[model samples]
Target: MTTAERSGAVQDPDARRLADLGYTSEFHRDMSLWANFSLGFTYLSPVVGVYTLFAVSLALAGPPMIWSLVIVGVGQLLVALVFGEIVSQYPIAGGLYPWARRLWGRRWAWLTGWVYAIALLVTIASVVYGAGPYVSSLLGLTVSTNTTIVCALVLIVLVTVINLGGTRVLAIAALIGFGTEILGALVVGGWLLLAEREHDLGVLFDSFGAAREGSYFAAFLAAGLIGIFQYYGFEACGDVAEEVPDASRRIPKAMRMTIYVGGAAATFVCLALVLAVPDFGAVISGENADPVGGVLSTAFGDTGAKIVLAVVLVSFLSCALSLQAAASRLMYSYARDRMLPGSGLLARFSRSRGVPPYTLLVAAVVPAVVVGVSRFSEDAIVKIVSFAVLGIYLAFQLVVLAALRARVKGWRPAGPFTLGRWGFAVNVAALVYGVAAIVNMVWPRTPDAPWYDDYLVLLSGVVVVGVGVVLMAVTRPYRHSDAAADDAVRSTAAPER
Candidate 1:
């Protein structure tokens, strides 16, 4: 037998699986099941999400806003199931980009990657900027535009350093971050329940009259925005699928588990905060704008609050790290396929570390520049978060919609994970939810504010997608290699069992 044939015969299943999909294994593939889960969990970061949006949710819908957590959680679970099915079959990196390409066509895939890549890079900035106030509070420094911008820049640099440490270090850091976040949630939530319960469980069902229009449903929809934003980072699991052993099977499980664990933790934390608030009326009326900090300080004294904030800071840093890592991988994946400009440099992997250093550098620098925009625009962070949410959900729904189309066209589950008879129903429900999410996210909440400010997310999303369409049409980036694309599609027509 030929030496190449002998090598193929003895190769790991993951390598063979990649070969069957018309690509060779390029990643180190050292991430364990737990490590893979950590990447998703840290990316989801309940602490970061809760802390960042707690005040906004409280103001929008009062205590009942907590229900948005449950509603968005269930909807996201449906979406995650559909994603799991796709990832199980393809098991490639770049998450939605690759799945969209395989299920649809090159143009669709290019747009998906274009939108998603920008969303992820901007998300890193939003996450770091969100963490700035907490870090400032921890350091006894006042949070101003300058301070927040500086802090965000510092965070971006620190995240870049950790990402440069290679996959093993990144995995270890993610696992540690996961532990800290979960433990902090339990300890803080448990303490609030035991010692500082200010209201009964019924408060969660009460809106406390914060629905300015006196319509509880309107308030609930507004609060649902937080839940929609928090559950998404779970896709970070599939973004690194190439680096996980037995990725076809393990990556899907990791994605679902991330939602399960992250959703549960987030729900618990929100409930604890709602039940622990000393003055719900004051919080909702803007009298106590920092409800999370107030609750922490009231439940656990200043020293204890500081301690919890330390854990939260770790969660934020880890979240930024995972975000950058996921973005780099997606960039590398697109570059490897020559879909992006300057693909050669961005696609180069470090011989020793097995990382795309240039890609990582780009990921870090882009966010830093995005964060700098805060200096000129006071509402920049809020608008950017809105843009990130709209962009990401749009990208996610594209894949889900593509999957639904494939289902109608006789796409069966070839991976270990399958939704079986429930797949069709779940896909339909997920698509419905995705459409609703996009509409809810883009709707202007503050009609009284400036037109640009009120409709920032909607306008920005349209511009970004419009730009992507224009670029795709002008560049025709996918026309360079029809033969290779054909080969890949044929090879993956029926993935090996």
Candidate 2:
């Protein structure tokens, strides 16, 4: 078949659907339902999330912090339902940006995409940077700040090259990563649970007196970071909607699957690690800063632990690759809509590969710069990455809020999948949960820390939105956008800003 044929532009219902929405199909619809689900699963990467945040969660709230995974999971499932309805109605590439535009307007879409795209880049840097220490250890090298950054740079470049190979390569990489990470999690976690468990299941309910000044409630809320980080990877499914056939129907399922499976895997892994930790007091008292590393070293011994870390490195690589792919599609979508600086160049796709090469370049370059700057102040980089998550959450809430606004204005979702009458309740619940999570994320939890450190997530969000406002006033990129061209999509009752 010709490239266009494979892209679903010839005798394909999916392509016809794209035409109905006023766009030519450019992505090859070769990704199966399994491939689509794998993309989100790999992006979610339970091993990566649980590993990265395990120390922080355990330290802040003791064993009880594991419940944050449950709290965040339930809340994010609501958000996923709202997203499912939106994507089912408008399975547009770039996910949130196009969803917001269709539900609200061009300017709303522009700002939403701006925040989300930048967050994706920063997340890429954060994921790969987290992988740096593991990479250094696996190579039997001393792990230093400079060495970690160098390892991260190498990872970014490698993933970028693989991403440029095209859609099939991306799908294969995701599948391999998904399989290895899941199997690795099960094996290692199972081993810990069966062989090296040092505490009973009841330990989950015990804070072990780790709470600050006997304030258990505050510490518990502060420990919700693990679940927050774990759930958003599901939206990566919808980010590449064009490449997945039957996206309106299948993508919603994939989003929910991403949450359900990712949440379970994360929780299971956490339960294993926490139960096997030789001492919770040690973790909370700052005596066991590397509890996770300690657990692996004990359970798997030296060589076996190295093998497990190698599997973890794969998860990290795939996670970065998935984030990069999501960012590329978002940028490409922006360019295709003529709502970005370099519309023509950014939108251009390689004919043989059916991928946006220039957009991929931007995805790689931004994250590399962020990783490079981390060498200056490693402390600031961590907070910046947290800000990245908050920015993404804000962008997500924009889409949810936009959907709610449309529902209030009498816009019903028309697609292969929807909530029907339950739409409003689910949408409201999702909004409520999302707002609460954001408050918990940005709330000042440290009295001794600098005010900027305490409020970086909130302040950084304001700065990003403020920058978007100024850019909108100057460039007005939305004026050039032809998306959401139908008046039916936007309610007449709501006046455009």
Candidate 3:
């Protein structure tokens, strides 16, 4: 039988189990496919993505960042298939953390949760850091270190307030942002492509030979690695499982749609930007403006560029809220299983409405810190955010691999989304793509590449993994056989008001 049919076939377990305690599976299924599509798009706006490509692909891979995006996109597609299988099966807000427990046993599950949690925290920082510069630029004010930090803190507080109100507010806000951002991006891209009709199409097509001052393949790889950030926010949907209207049916659909929407939107924006290829020598020349910032300036003039800047700023802020929402879930998920440091408080659902407030507080820290750091140095801020995002993607890919391994061994989940035999092939492709991206990001490019930045990504990832391992060693509770079963249901299944 198919996965959807299988869910109906399975019997619900007895209600008295401790694992079922206080879980809130209350997400509404009111979100349409487009809303789901925007969930990812809002995360991968043209403004932020352009900077990412310039740094990763153009700076390093020359024109190969385009190819890198293609490679990463394909890998993400396969990985999404894995996510499809899992989300369809579990449909819980906890996402990969719960899946890891079920597939790899509890210790491994907690380990997976640790990595995922840390990744989200880092992503929150990156999002805030990315946004602050855009905000500073749009306001025509010089960005100061203290100002950036304070703004980041404010952004976190704003996001926390929105999340506390729950899913309805987020979905509505996301829909509005998605529409505004998409129209702005298309207009900006259309102007660039149409106005620059005289520019060389050949440059856009054949720029691959123009590698940075490094190994050609390594440059290409690093650039492609950077594109991973373009695809970061899709997982945020999974984090809000408790708030999704019809989570079981909608979550997988939302996830798949997110990839399609983000890929198409990103592709359109890139094409427009590529057609207007700035002087490579000039762009790379010291003191040339941010290529993306420069391009928008050309396409819209000063006034229009600032408008685009505002949109980009809003896009990042949207992502900031989404990141906070996702991180809160991660904390709640970890605490739910007693994996994090403050399970009692962090795990507690509000007595008034059953929301987990303490966990939300914990998730607010990284973004606040990210904002503070951006004022010191934009370059350092960007690199730190990039490093953190890389760690998050790595964790995401690893969990997918672990889950795929279990599925290949004849494990089955009763869900609406299923890959069947194609699961293995798709999953393997995703695994390969993820591995390539990780290596690309870590590989050194040239003597010019800062030593601290070069090692920071590696060190941060190591620290996250080491912490997970240590926690596993100290807890010892995860060794139980029943922990591997990891079945959890809502404390009350009635639909949300």
- Find the candidate with the highest lDDT and give its number: 2
What's the TM for model 3? 0.86
Score candidate 2 by lDDT. 0.86
lDDT by candidate, in order shown: 0.86, 0.86, 0.65
For every model shown, the clashing-pair count is 0, 0, 10
What's the CA error at residue 132 for candidate 1, in Å? Answer: 0.6
TM-score of model 1 vs. true structure = 0.96
RMSD of 2: 3.1
In the range 170-220, model 2's lDDT, one tens digit per residue, is 999998988898899899989999999999989998889888686789888
Model 3 Cα lDDT, one tens digit per residue, 24-79: 33334345556655655576554566654464356555544666556666677777
Better of 1 and 3 by lDDT: 1
For model 3, what is the C-alpha lDDT against the true structure? 0.65
Candidate 2 runs further than 4 Å off: 1-10, 485-497
